[model samples]
Target: MAVDPRGVDLKRLLAEDSGEPLVMLNLLRFAEGGAESYREYARRLSETFLPRYGGEVLYAGTGSTVLVAEDGQSWDAVIIVRYPDRTAFSRMVADPEYQEVTRLRTAALAEAVLQATTPWS
Candidate 1:
């Protein structure tokens, strides 16, 4: 099933098969406030990036992990998205939506790291 972070559905993805080896990642970060730019970026992504990435997001969501650190003390939300292949992920980041909104995301995020890994099943 697709459960990367809290974005989309998994079973409908095209680039990956549930039984095949999949890449998993855990995105860790410290972001807060619902009104911040990152939230807007997320909204825009929900509107733009999601559709743009399409199938790539499905493969990416499976086996993904997201963690939000302490509330008021520091961190906020964590995100993890899957990709059928590292190359596909690389391409997605270079896409126009990512290129623009990513910068906005960084500005809102205090600390973020994309932990891309392969999980053996």
Candidate 2:
């Protein structure tokens, strides 16, 4: 039920760099009454941090009916983001300004799955 990434997580992400664009899959479970905060975080990210860090939100949406999953496995939202590279992603998370905004995301989520993806050859 971890809602935020730790320093070690970022370090591990960097260590696995492929020198190619990195895509991150985000599965979010919102805390009660926390949707608005997450929206605000997303807005700021799309408007400023993303551009500054060479990142783009590929897709974002609320989860609908679960097509396939365990009873409690349904997510509240999903977002896919692409970064120029793992370094760019790492830098964004380390930015002082971004650090401030990230609190909204952390507070909004009860649980989250933030996983990096590799495209097929």
Candidate 3:
């Protein structure tokens, strides 16, 4: 139900920083008519905010049939985005302009999982 990260969540993310690039794994379940709205959010993110914050979309795709997952665990979409670091991601979310368009993302999702990933050695 929580689409956006909270202040405490941000603090925890920063505290765990390893000074390496972070890849965010986003699992999304769209509400009715949410896909279109999410598309607009993606457009703004790819065109403006991502560049400003040194972030980029590594992959974005609609979810298909789940080969392996518990019942009611399938997602509507999956996206991977890379940020220079946790601080950059935190700053982007804090940006005034980015905040304006965040509603689109929030309104579009019934549920979401935003997880930060570290590369394997």
Candidate 4:
């Protein structure tokens, strides 16, 4: 049921200064008729916000049958997005214009997991 990060979450993210590129792992579950809405959100995000924040989609794909997972653990889609850094990601989310378009994404998902990943060295 956690679709978007909160202000506190962003603050916490910013407090950790890794100073490295971040990859966000997104696990999404759409509500009925929500995939279409999410598609629109994705289009707007890619065109308007991503470049502004130096972000890019590494991968996006619809989920299929889960070969291995706990019960009630399957997702509807998965997306991996790379951002220049945590600050860039934070700024993108806080942008006024991006906030307006985020409504579509909020409406589209029943549940989501947005996790920041650092490459293992």
Best by lDDT: 3
Q: Quote each prediction's TM-score.
A: 0.53, 0.98, 0.98, 0.97
Put down candidate 2 lDDT per residue, 11-110, tens digits, no spaces. Answer: 9999999999999999999999899999999999999999999999999999999999989899999999999999999999999999999999999999
- The local distance difference test score of each candidate is 0.48, 0.95, 0.96, 0.95
lDDT of 4 by residue, 1-121 (tens): 6799999999988888599998999999998999999999999999989999999999999999899999989999999999999999999999999999999999999999998887899
Order of the predicted models by lDDT, top scorer first: 3, 2, 4, 1
Model 3 spans > 4 angstroms off:
none
Please list the residue runs of candidate 1 whose C-alpha ends up more than 4 Å from where it truly belongs after superposition.
1-35, 55-74
lDDT of 3 at 53: 94
Give candidate 3's error at residue 39 in angstroms: 0.3
What stretches of model 4 exceed 4 Å from their correct place?
Answer: none
Candidate 3 TM-score versus the reference? 0.98
lDDT comparing candidate 4 with the true structure: 0.95
* Cα shift from native, residue 87, model 3 (Å): 0.6
lDDT of 3 by residue, 61-81 (tens): 999989999998999999999
Q: Lowest-scoring 10 consecutive residues by lDDT in candidate 1?
A: 1-10
